[model samples]
Target chain A: MSPLHLCLALSAALFCTGLVAVLIRGNAILVLLGVELMLNAANLNFLAFWRFGPGGGEAGLVFVLFSIAVAAAEAAVGMALVIAVHRHLRSIRIADANRLKG
Target chain B: MTTLLAVLALICLAPAVAAVLVRNLIHSALLFVLAWLGLAAFYLALGAEFVAFAQALVYVGGVSMVALFAVLLTRPGRTDLLPPPSAARAVGGLAAVSLVASMLASSLFWSRLPSMEPTAPIPLRRLGELLAGPYLVAVLLVGLILTVALIGGLLLAAPRRPAEGADA
Candidate 1:
């Protein structure tokens, strides 16, 4: 298989795994990890398209860098929220917290 | 080239699955670190040296640490890391994942994928120029966002001081 095809397949599989993780995991942290995995998979798609797409690939790199920055910020805020939730609920399981169920 | 790609695939995918599978939150976090490192390797394979370095530095050095810290701070006394999901939930997840995977595979196979290899590596100087030029606003915005997020996170995570009389 071509490198592009290989990368596309790899990224697709990873994205699926991440989605499953998100759907199944009860722990908020694990869910966060799943989100991160999904983000990485998307970034991989960008890089692959950039490498294999017509025209130049600089735009893809730029987008990837920006995405990484945004992801770091997201992780920070997400962990903070997780910590705050744990403080209030004393548990980190998603199934246990039902404050928003109403 | 194929060998390198295979190794990179292993590095990224295996630990990712393992991270989700492992019962220990700490182990999961560490395996995630490995997966992030593999992602950096993927960027390298694509010849984006700057991105690869940045990915390694940020995700591995920064985000993973933050996750570990969060895990430690919020740890329950005798809680299970791998909580059991219902059979229905597992089946739903599997179905959703498989559906998405099939769609992706079909799209990839149907498209006329181009194969333009990078003849030369993108220079750091050019990237800086682009970031400072047309993308300057985006660059500034990212910096602004990060700053705000950091301050907000600190405020949220900071220990609340008890009122003097209330505590006593």
Candidate 2:
């Protein structure tokens, strides 16, 4: 397989691992980490296509940069939410965070 | 070259798998940093030097610190072992993930991907121009969003004051 194919396959596998982590893990932080993994997988796909596809320009690179910034923002907000939830519930387990208001 | 890619893939994936499976929250967070570093290496291999550095700085540097801090701040006890998920939940999640993975792999293989030659990496200077020129609006928007998010995060994570003399 070409390097492009290899990159795509790796991205798919990473995405799948992330999905499983999100679905199975009880910890809110791990679930957030899983989301980060999925986002990174998507960024890898973008970089792969940009490297191999026609009309190679700066668009893909720019998009990935924006994506990285957004992902960082998401991580900040999500972690804050996790901390808030933990303060309220005294546990970071997703199952324990059943109530909407405390 | 293919063998190198295979090695890189192993480096990227193993820590991710271990992170998910490991019971300790701190270990899981650190393992994620390893996975991010592997991904940055992949970016370097792909000839996106700027992106690779940004990935290293932003992800491995910034986000991993955030994750580690969150993990530390929210740990319930001395030993941060997460309880094992229910067997049914684990099996079901694995089955669903595998189904999606198979579908993605089959589609990827069956599609006629263009066999294009790898292009020269864009100069960092040109990339900067594009960001300031055509993508200026997007850059501004991202900045705005990031500022808002940071402020929101601070507000959300701040300690609440106890109600004082409310009934008096």
Candidate 3:
């Protein structure tokens, strides 16, 4: 009933949704969104544990801040790679990248 | 009161599912933004101010923009149509649903859980100090990893101009 439990449940659900998106979606962008969802879900877990765990207040907050910095850098590099690959391949559909089947 | 919190959890999840399931790419992207905002609010309600800011600034602002830009770059004339659903997708959905159900059941039925209230939370400065103290080795390793990743990304994304000997 507590907000902490609520955060956990939502994070779990989002992670599952992301799992489905990653497995089912053919588009690379959709897959990237799924990845973002999973990352956010993990972030929520950290924050919730912070709020309710034995390390409340600022320790969790500090860790979450570091996580955000990491996520931002990851996003930048990931999108750049996506752009570069798109330029080389002219398509974003994961299915279209059939050369990898070998 | 517990029921209300559970219901709100469902509300938070429903849009995330929709964001994943929608066939339209643009709709999926927009729904993803909403999902981030929802999670950010949830983080705030849970008394995680730093997490809320990170969700707002990093995922909402940085990741989402990058995703949208990637979408714009790779989409071709296929923008007018929906991608056909595949047979394998059903199994993936089933797996995801089963994972969610199992996690929910465990959380609901688990007889014992640790709930500790913090008495002395180290401040952000202390966290940094700790990271630099006993955790210094791990921090240094992560820094090295990130540095390599950045260099790799730069090597990959460096732009190339058009050839000079093209059809002049």
Candidate 4:
């Protein structure tokens, strides 16, 4: 079996586990962790494809760098929002914030 | 190579599962850090040293800290950090994830992929050139986005004065 396939399989497994975490966990922070896992899975795929693809992986490296930067921004803003939600609602549970529901 | 892959896979996934299954939020968050470290190892195995270090610095050093701090800052008294998932809900999550994973693995077999070349790793110098050359605009935009996010995070998480909210 090709190493690429193994990497791809690993990425798939990580992504799936993240999906389960996002669905099964109630804590907003855990959900955020799940999202981080998903993002890392995607990043892994990028690296694998870049390595195994016909051309050089320069493009993939650049893309992964950009993705890392964006993920950092996303994590910062998401955590900040979580803190704000907790301040307003007194709880960080996703189900607890239902004030705007009709 | 295959053995390294196996070890890295175990390092990455075992903690991921533990992170999800663990009861304590702080422990789960730290487990997530271990998972990210495994991901960095994967990058290193692919011979992408620059990307791997960036992964460790950004995820391990930066994002994980933010998550842990979010957990610490928000929690006050003795309360449930993670309420257990209902039986039906847990089963559904497992079923859905398995379905998606099977679909993804099946699709990978349908296409004939190129074999990897044992080429030298991309140098950090070349990467810097690419960032400043063809990908300049994207790099600039990422910088702008990160700056905005930093400022926005500060604005959102800053404590408010009582006088400001007295009218409300």
Candidate 5:
């Protein structure tokens, strides 16, 4: 298999695992971790493409940097939301959060 | 070259899958951090220096820490902290498998993409120029948005009226 090919497969696997965790899990923290895993998987894909795809090194590198900064910001916001949820509900379980609509 | 990359790629994926499957939330989060590190290694293998470092700095240093703190804030009594999947979670597992398989197949076959040219050096400086030249506006806007969000979070987390109208 091509080296880039292997990286792509790995990224895909990471993303899929993350997706599974996000979808089936009832814990908010686990869900957040799942999301982070998904984001990293995509970033890996970007880096791989940059390395072996068309973006080449520099442009891909810079773009990935931008993505990382954005991910950081997203993490901050996400954590804030988690704190809010924990405070309001006193439970980190997602199944219990159904009070809003259910 | 292919073998080296393949090995590195496997290394990246192992912990990533473990991150999702582990029982303890804290341990899983730690594994997630390691997974990101592996991805950074993959980036380096691809010759994308900036991407690799950015992954470490932003993902490892920034995002992962935030995730840890957020998770730390949540330590509900052991009454209810559900772990991994049961047989009922089979549907999700199936979907995940299908998704990974499809993506790999499409990228490998349908794209027919030519491997990057090995002779030409990566245009690192050009990216820098573009960042300052054309992408600065977007970057500044994003920063402004983040500032606003941070302020909003602080406001939300501020002390509020207690239930039963107790003034404290």
Candidate 6:
């Protein structure tokens, strides 16, 4: 396979693994990790296209930088949410957090 | 080069799989760090040195610490007593994920992507100018969002005050 194809395949695999983790994992923190993995996969795709495609690639680089910053902010907020949930429920399991069931 | 890319792919993927499967939350978090490092290696191989270092700093350094802290704060003394997911739920989730993966893979292979020789890496100075000149608004917006998120996270995680009337 060409390098671009290789990168795309790797990105797809990583994204799928992350999806499985998010779908099956019970812990909220692990779910957040899955989200991070998916975000990284997208970043990989951007860099791959930037390297292999025509033009300056400036847009892709800037986009990845912004994406990384957003992911960091997301992790901070997500962890805080997880901590708050644990404080309230004394557990972080997704199955255990069902207070809003109506 | 293909062989090196394959190795990097393995490095990037294996820890991620292990992180999902591991029983200990702390171990899982650390495994995620390894996976992130592997992704940084991929960036380096792709010739994006700045992105590679940024990935290492933000993900391996910052995000890993956050994940570990969350795990520790939540777990405290109790080990993970949660039972494994029910067989039906696990099967359903796996099936859905597999279906999605297959679809994505098929589409990616079918599409006609334009391929060219890998280009020279953009200079660090040029990147700075683009960020400051054209993308300055986006940078400022990101700064605002980060500040807001920081304050919001602090508020959410802060300890609540006891009811004074009830105590009295």
lDDT of 6 by residue, A6-102 (tens): 9999999999989988988878998999999999999999998898877677799889999999999999999999998898888788878899742
TM-score of chain A for the candidates in order shown = 0.93, 0.95, 0.83, 0.92, 0.87, 0.94
Poorest stretch of ten by lDDT in candidate 4 chain B:
B159-168
Single out the weakest 10-residue window by summed lDDT for candidate 6 chain B: B76-85
**lDDT (tens digit, per residue) of candidate 4 on B1-168:** 878888888888999999999988888999999999988988898899988999999999999999989998988467535668788878888888888988988888786776676456777888899999999999999999999999999888876655475565
Candidate that would win on DockQ: 2
Q: Over the stretch B101-144, how does candidate 5's per-residue lDDT look in tens digits?
A: 68766866665556664334356786678788878886787788
Flag regions of model 5 displaced more than 4 Å: A54-59, B78-93, B96-100, B103-111, B119-125, B159-168
Score each candidate by Cα lDDT.
Answer: 0.87, 0.90, 0.70, 0.87, 0.72, 0.90
Retained native contacts per candidate, as fractions? 0.75, 0.82, 0.57, 0.78, 0.56, 0.81
For candidate 3, write residues B1-168 as lDDT tens digits: 346546656666778888877887878888888888877767656655555766788777877887777777666575634465588876776777787769776975673446555334345577668678866775676677678767876766666775477556
Candidate number of the best lDDT: 2
Better of 2 and 5 by lDDT: 2
Q: Estimate, for each residue in B93-156, the C-alpha lDDT of model 6 and write its tens digit.
A: 8999999998999999898888789878999999999999999999999999999999999998
Q: What ranges in model 3 sit over 4 Å off?
A: A55-59, A100-102, B1-11, B78-81, B96-100, B115-151, B159-168
Question: In candidate 5 chain A, what residue range of length 10 has the lowest lDDT sum?
Answer: A54-63
Ranking by DockQ: 2, 6, 1, 4, 5, 3
Worst 10 residues of 3 chain B by lDDT: B111-120
Clashes by residue pair, model 6? none
Q: Tens-digit lDDT track for model 1 on B3-93?
A: 7887899888999999888888899999999998998998898888999999999999899999999999998676546667789988888
> What CA root-mean-square deviation does each model show from the true structure?
2.6, 3.1, 4.1, 3.1, 3.6, 3.0
- Tell me the docking grade of candidate 2: high
TM-score of chain A of 5: 0.87
Q: Point to the candidate with the largest TM-score.
A: 2
In candidate 2, position B79 carries an lDDT of: 79
Report the lDDT of model 2 for residue B94: 84
